[model samples]
Target: MSRESITPNGLNPDRETIQLGKLTVPRLFIGLWQLSSTGWGTTSVTRVRREMRRHVEAGYNAFADHYGTAEQIFGGFRSTLPDPKVVVGATKWCVFAQIDITRSVVQAAINERKEKMAYDRVDLLQFHWQDYSDRQYMDALEYLQEFKNSGDITELGLVNFDAARTDEICTQFPGLIVSNQVQFSLIDTRPLDGMGDVCNKHGIKLLTYGTLCGGFLSEKWLGEPQPDEYGGPMTPSQRKYLDVILGAWGTWPLFQSLLQTLQAIGGRHGHRSISNIATRWILDHDFVGCVLVGSRLGLTEHIDDNDRAYGFRLTPEDNAEIEKVLEKSKGRELVRVLGDCGAEYRRGGGHE
Candidate 1:
């Protein structure tokens, strides 16, 4: 509702930007993981292209993808843009096999990502290691550091890595790692437990996801009854976050209470939505460089609503009200169960 000047990309002139290594990107990144049609519902290529354009037009110039088909889809669309250089691309590589740790194999993986994404060099290349027990991840990072030195990768990052491991890596490579992508929403503040401190000490930033809890944090679920198992229409992301909501966050009824509280707080700030408030809450954190919101592309659109997040600031009373509800929630225990950021995925179970 604020009369802020709009940029050509549809971004508010006041919207902030962050430095991820050498690339400067918007604080809100369009998450392309939904582009992969395996877990998330089907999405047409046309929709994907349109959605990317929508984000760029709206002033969100950064996109994040994993090393899956998402890279291919995003790259394919990016090539068609009038000015592709305006977009900042970040992707992840999950090390699931021992071969991926070797220098030759790692180089091949990098080359494959470049070819698949149709980019000469990736702005940020985040690595995800399933088995921390294997020291091959260290070797992989060493190789990635070499690539970063040679300019094949603009920046090196980590996905779902814990604070201890992050610290170890920082000690090993100093300023090579710029960011760590993790799930850090109001419902899951695991990063604040220790990861935040580590990042602060090491000058590393956090790019957070799961902030909206796969749309559950939105107003659509307000006052709704808990869906019976296999009864309600839900996407894979919703189902996965539902487990987190029910498991460590709180019961369904309590979640509804929190949603109602968010609605009330948002109303005070020019009638913002629950999702916007949830995202704004994470963005307010000093350690967070950006928040990644899942974009379902053509199936659903919330660009206007999302833009509202940066329109107003949350008051201290708003934080107090949210915290009052959180005090009764099981967030601490949830962090314990989930371990550190990205522990669910490493355990062989998590939202895709």
Candidate 2:
């Protein structure tokens, strides 16, 4: 579809957005979870700044990050954008509260992060509860809630909360949570096991990661051996997760067939890649405010290709064809085998 004929659903949707409380963010937000980390490359601040300029020029307004240095990366150059409108950012606090998450300590961190990011307030500070057993969870939530209520944060939410626990939190603090980040993607539909319906009922939207399954669902991985050889001596989180999906989806040959079907339909739509099809398929699944597609900073930029997803919408026939392929192979039941959509943190005791 031509840009002239298509309607943009987001900022440029050439970027994208969703309602995070009162704040609107790009539909396809730039994820910085791996940025500033060495696994991908030596991220130079200069290069990262340039990437942000290009990304903003493309219309993507949100950046989600986790590590301490993440704030530093975006914080270093706060005045480069167009009137603080280029990007709306979100970062996570890994739920490692020390005994009591003293308000002074929490406020100090927020101030530091806010000052570094060059914003009066953070658009969102995602709360990550590593373990439900920790008593500090309450203290942390209290302070986080205080921040949200006082407008230090545009909004506050959780990452990877189980359905049961999510219900408990909402009951404890009514009408406060605007969203929850989860692992919703082609391979992980675990949230649909009643969580999404409940979210709709209670007014919470879901921000999903792994939507592309670490490139496994793309054309490149369709017919390959699933890369059991592991990219290096130290396996990556995404690669390992893809390996598991491959196991669940049967073998490489079956996945290849699935990819081919997507390719055929995608080709019909001028996309020619399964990744675009997979992304479009999720847009209307309900309660999905947006999907988190990561940025490798220096590795690759798919911003232009990602824009393809917005110009078109999938059809019933399109979904049926995709499902037919999915039926042939095993679907993602890893959440069942592992736990709820994001119950991995509690089970594995946080990321390795």
- Best model number under TM-score: 1
Per-residue lDDT over 1-352 for candidate 1, one digit per residue giving the tens place of the 0 to 100 score:
1222223644576677888778898888989877665556776787777777777778887889873578887788778765567788899888765564568887887988888888888778988887888888889899999998998888889998999999999998899899999989989999989999989989989999889988999988999999654676777778878988886788999999899999999888889899989999999888899999888777877888888888577889999999999989999776688788878777874433
What is the lDDT of every predicted structure here? 0.84, 0.71
Global fold similarity of model 1 (TM-score): 0.94
Q: TM-score of model 2 relative to the true fold?
A: 0.88
Clashing residue pairs in candidate 1 (N, C-alpha, C atoms within 3 angstroms): 9-57, 9-58, 9-59, 10-58, 11-58
lDDT of 2 by residue, 1-352 (tens): 1111112233443444678788787677777777645765565777877776677666765778756466767755446543564467887766543455689877887787687777888778777777678767767778878887787888887888878777778778777788788887656678878778768877888888788876666877666564655554322556656665666656667767877888888988875468888887776677887788877775678877787777777778987887786666656566577677677667766651
Estimate the TM-score of every prediction. Answer: 0.94, 0.88
Largest lDDT belongs to which candidate?
1
